[model samples]
Target: MDRHAPSTRCAVITPQLSKRAARAGSDRRSPEARLEEAVGLAAAIDLDVVFKGLVLLSEVKPATYLGSGKVEEIAGIVQAEEVGLVFVDAALSPVQQRNLEKAWSAKVVDRTALILEIFGSRARTKEGTLQVELAHLNYQRSRLVRSWTHLERQRGGFGFLGGPGETQIEADRRQIGERILRIERDLEQVKRTRALHRTSRKRVPYPVAALVGYTNAGKSTLFNRLTRAEVMAQDLLFATLDPTLRAVDLPHGTRVILSDTVGFISELPTQLVAAFRATLEEVIEADVILHVRDISHPDTEAQAADVRDVLTELGVDPEAGGRVVEVWNKIDLLPEDERDRMVNTAARADATDRPTLVSALTGEGADGLLDRIESLITAGRVMLTVTLPAEDGEGLGWLYRIGEVMEREIGEDGLMRASLRILPERVDLVKRRFGAAQVRTEV
Candidate 1:
C-alpha cells in the first residue's frame, strides 16, 4: 500500500460573531447540529474527521478570522493530535487562509472552499465537471495570493522584463482564464442540446413536475421511490448535483415527465447559484413543483422557509397560484401521536394548501401523492362526446393519444360514439377533424 494514501482526518472550527437578536433568532439552530451536518457531509465524501471546535473571533487580534492566541492554541492541538486538515465553518478572506495555514502548518479551508472541493469531488457528468471547474476557477481567481510563490520567469529574450523571477500568480490566473473560456464554449453546446430536448418534450405536451427542497430533505428519496432509479440519495449536503429526468405514469395512465433538481439551502453562495444556472433552469421550466419537506425535523418549518426563499430568488412562486404542491415527507420519523395530530390538523385547515404527508422511505401515502399530481395535471380537461364514421379510425386514435377515454358506444347509424376528457387544445383539433355535426355533447 502507498504510504501517502489520501488523508481523511480533519477538524472543524466555527468562529463566534454577534448580530442582532432577530438575526440570531432566525438562526436558532444549535451549533452542534450544524457541526454534525458538516461532519456528515465530509464523511459522505470519504473524509475522516478527528476533531471539531468552535472559537470566538470577535475578540481575536491581528487577524480578522482567527485571533493570534486562538491560532496558537489550535496549532498546538493540530501538532499534538496529528490532524491533517482544519476546516473553518465560515467565510475567510484569502489573507486569513494563508495566515492560518502558515501558523497551523496544515491545510486550512473555509466554508466556501470546502463546498467547492465537495462539488469538485462529486461532479460526475461532463457538464457538471465543466460547471465545477468554472466555479473553481472563479473562486481561485480571487485567491491567487495563496499561490504566488510558485511562478517562474521566461529565459533570455523576455527575462529582462521581470528579472527572471515573475510571480506564478499571474501565470495561474492566465491559465485559469483560458480554461474558463473553453468551459464556457463547451457549456454553450450543452445548453443548445438541452434546449432541443426541451422542445421535443413540449411537442408531446407532457406536463413537467419538478422536485425541489432542502438538501437531505428526502427529495431524492421521494424521486427514487416514484421513478425507481438510484440517484445517489444520501444524507449529505449537495449529494445530487445534477438534474435527472424520468417518465412517471400517473394512476390514470397519463404519462408526464418528472425532473429531480439540485436541493436548495440557506445562504447558498451567490457564486454557486450563478454557476449552476444551467442545471436550475429545469426547475424554472417545470409546469408544476413539489416542495418536499422533512416534517420530522424540529426545524422543519424553518427548513421550509429556506427552500421557499431560494425558489423565490429563482422566480418560482411558492403559492404557485395553484401550480405547486407542498409535500411533507419523512413521516416515518415522526411519532405516531405527532403524525396523527398533523394529519388531523391538515384535514381541518386550508392553510399551506393542506400539504400531503408521506414517508418516502417506507412508501406510505405514495398513492395519495400520485392522485394529487394527477388532479393538478388534469384539472383543466373538458368532457366531450363525439361521433365519427366507422372507417375514420384516426379520430378515435387521436382521442386515445391525447385524452382519457371515459366511455365508448356503438350508435344505431353505424357510427362510433365516445365520451372523453381531453385537453382544450386537443378538443379543438378533434372538432377540426370531425365537423360540428359529429359533436353531440360538450361540458
Candidate 2:
C-alpha cells in the first residue's frame, strides 16, 4: 500500500502433487504452466520473484505441505535471497501455513491469499473494493494464527483482517463475522441496483453482450477493439478487476451494450466467487455471452474448461445451446499454417457449434465476429409493425426507445408506419402497447 516502501522479495513454490490428486480435482494443467501462472500472479502485485520452483510432491504433508528436507532447502533460499514473503501455489491449512512461515522465517501466503491480495490491490470501484475486502475478511477469519498473536503491544492492524488480538481469536472472528454480514448486505443492494440497470437497458434499443474468459485471454483487448475504449487491457493476471460497459454499434446499425468483466482463473478462491457473485451476474443476464480464449496457449483447452466450470457454478448452462459463444482469440501469435488450419476448421464446423477465431490484438476477423454476435442477438426475436398518428410522435419515440426501428415510413394520410425487431420477452408488451397494424414472428 505504501508507494515509498521497498518491494517485497518473494518466492513462488508450486506443489505438483500426485496424478491421483490431479484426477480427483480435475486439474490437467502441467506443473510448469501452473508454476508460470503462480509467478504471473506474484508479478501482478509487483512482488519481486527472487525464487520460483515447482516441487513434485509424492504426497502433501499436513505440517508444511512440503517434505522436511524441502522445507529446509527453501529456508536456505529465503535467507540467501532475503525473501520477505513466500507464496505456496496451493491451498494450505492454518497450521501448515504457520509452520512454513516459521521454517522459512518469511510471511507465508497460499494461492488463495495471494489472489485475494492482488484483488485487494487491483480493485478500483467501490463495489469491487467491497467485494475484495469481504473476501479478504472471510479468508482471514480462518487464519487465526500468528497474525493475531501479538496481544500485549496494542497497535493498529489490517482493516478487517486483523484486530490487535484485543480479546482473543474468537473476538477477532466476531469482528470479521460482523464485517462479512455488512458487506453481504451492501452487495445485495449492489445486485438489486444492477438488476434495475438491466431492466433500464431492456427499455432501450441495445442488447447486452458480456465478455467472459480465463485471465489474460485477450478479452480486454477484444473489448477495446470493439468498443474503442481504454480499459487497462494488460497481459498480467487480473489486470481489470471492475466491470466496464460501453456501447458498440453492429454492422447492420444494431447497437449492443458490451460488458468487460473480471476474468476467471483455475481454482479461484471460493470466497472470491461468493463475494463477487453480484459482479458476475452480468454474465448471467447477458443477452449474448462471449467465452474468449487464448487459443495460442498450450493449455487453452484446460483453461476453457475452468471457465465453463465457473459459468456452470454461476447458474448459466455453458452447453445449453445458444446464449454462449466461444471466441478463440490471440491468433496473431499463432503460426501461419496453424492459423489457416484453425480458420478452415471453424469454417467447416456446424453453425451452432462454430467458434470464432480472431486476433483481438490485430483486429483480425473482428468484423465476422461482430456479424456472428449480431446474428445471435437477433436470433428468434420478434418482428412487428405499428401504425400511429403522425401527431402522436411520443408513441413513435417510445418504440424507438425499446425496439430496433428497422424501417419507418410517413404516408400521405399522416400516419407513421414503423417495423421493429424486439426480444421475444417484450413481444407481448409491444403488441399490447402499439395495437400494431401487423405482427410477425421470427421463430
Candidate 3:
C-alpha cells in the first residue's frame, strides 16, 4: 500500500571507487547489489527512479563529489529524463549537494536524506514524529552552510550589503533551534514515561522479547506470526516504523511481551539513532532479543553485521550468552538442499541458545523457536510450588498475574497446590505475600 501521496521522478547515482581498499569480513557484495539496494531505498519513499547508473570514481572531487565530465554527463541525463530529483547513493557534503543541484537543475538528496524522508513519512505516533523531526532538523542544520555569496551578506554592514536569503536563513536557523529544544523537552518526558511503564511491568512482570533485524528481513512478519497481530508486515523497506508491543503466549503457557521495532540498515545516520534513543530503550530492557535474519538473501552475513553494529550501539550484546538468539528466517524461499543445510547447521550448534531455522510465512519450525524463547526468557527464573487454601482467590489471582502457573491441583483438605515460574527478584515478595512456609523454590 502506498502511504506517500506525492511521487517524484528521480535519478539514482551510485559512485564507487575504481580500486577499493580491501576490507575484512564477508561483506564483498557486488556493485550491482549495492545499486539495487539503493534503488530500493529510493522506492521506499515512493520516488520513481527514471534513470539510474553506477559511476566509478578514481577520486572524489571536493566541490561536486563526481568528476566534472561525469557531472556534465549526469546533467544531460537529468535534463533528458526531466528528473525532478537526483539521489546520490553516497554521503554528500553541503557544498557538493548544492553544486550538484545547481549543475543538474534538480534537488539533490543523498542516501541519508532518502532514509530520513522514508522515516518522516512512516512515523505514526507522537514520539515517533518527534524523533523524526528532531533528526530531520539536526540533519538540516548541517546543510545551512553559506553556499551562495549573497547568503553570506550581513544586514547593516559597513558596505551596506545584505541578501534577503541571509535574513531568511537566520530566521530559519532560529526557528529550527527553538523546535529542537521543544522536541528535546518532549522526548525527555517520553523517556521518563517509558521508564515508568517498565517499572509498572515489573510489578506483574512478563518477560519481554524484542525483534530486531535488517530492513525488509521479515522482522515484522515474524512478529506478526508469533503475536498473531497484523502490524504492516510487507516486503517494502521500513514497513514497520513505530514500535509495537504485544503479549504472546509461549509453548509452555508462559506469556511474554513481544516488541517489534524499526528495522536497522547499513550506514544508519548517527543523528537518527540519537534521536530515536528513547524508542530503542525497549530493546535494552528486553529480557531476550530475537535477532531475525533473512538467510535467503545473498548478503545475509553482511546484513547481520550491520544489525549487530546497531545492537552494540544500543548496549545489547549479541554474542553474550543468553542475550540474543539468532533466528534464521525466510527458509521457505530457500531450495530444499539449502533448507536442510540450515537445519543441520542449527542442530549442530552446542551453545545454550543456538540459532533457530524457521519460516514465519508458513509457520514452519515455529514451535522450536517458541520453546527456545521460553527457555531464554526463564533462564534465571525460579520454579515454586505454593500450597494455599482453596478459598484464597486473591492469593491465586496474584500468583497468576505475577508468575506463570505451570500446574494447579486442589487437595481433599481444601488446599490448593500450584506450581509457578517466577523471576528471582520477585521470589522474596511472593514468599512474603504468601507465608514462606507455604512456598517451595527451585532453581
The number of the candidate with the highest TM-score is: 3
lDDT of 2 at 278: 87
Q: TM-score per candidate, in order?
A: 0.87, 0.92, 0.93
Instruction: Tell me the tens digit of each residue's lDDT in model 2 across 265-381.
Output: 998999898888888888988989999999999999999999999999989988855789999999999999999898998889888879998899999989999999999998877
lDDT of 3 by residue, 1-443 (tens): 36566578899999876655323442456677778889989988888899989998878889999999999999999999999999998889999998999999999999888888889989999999999999999998877765743475544434344556667677878999999999999999998988898888776777889999999999888888888899998888899899999999898888889999999988788788898778888999998888999999988888888899889988888787687999999999999998888888888887765798889999997888999999888787899999999989999999988888989999989899999998788889888998899999864
**What lDDT score belongs to each candidate, Candidate 1 first?**
0.78, 0.87, 0.87
Write candidate 1's Cα lDDT for 1-443 as tens digits.
Answer: 12368756788787655443124444646566667666755665566688887675444344537777888999998998888888887777777887788899888887777877877777888988988888888888887663233332332235544533344556777998999899899989998899888887776657789999988889888999998989899878788888889999988776778898887766666568778889888888888798999899877787788888878888988877457789989989888999999899778867437788899999998989888887888788888888887777777887776667767888888988888777777767778778867765565
Give the Å shift of residue 290 in candidate 1: 0.6
- Which model, 2 or 3, shows the larger TM-score? 3
Candidate 2: lDDT over CA atoms? Answer: 0.87
Backbone clashes in model 1, listed as residue pairs: 151-168
TM-score of 2: 0.92
TM-score of 3: 0.93
- Misplaced by over 4 Å in model 3 are 1-6, 18-28, 148-167
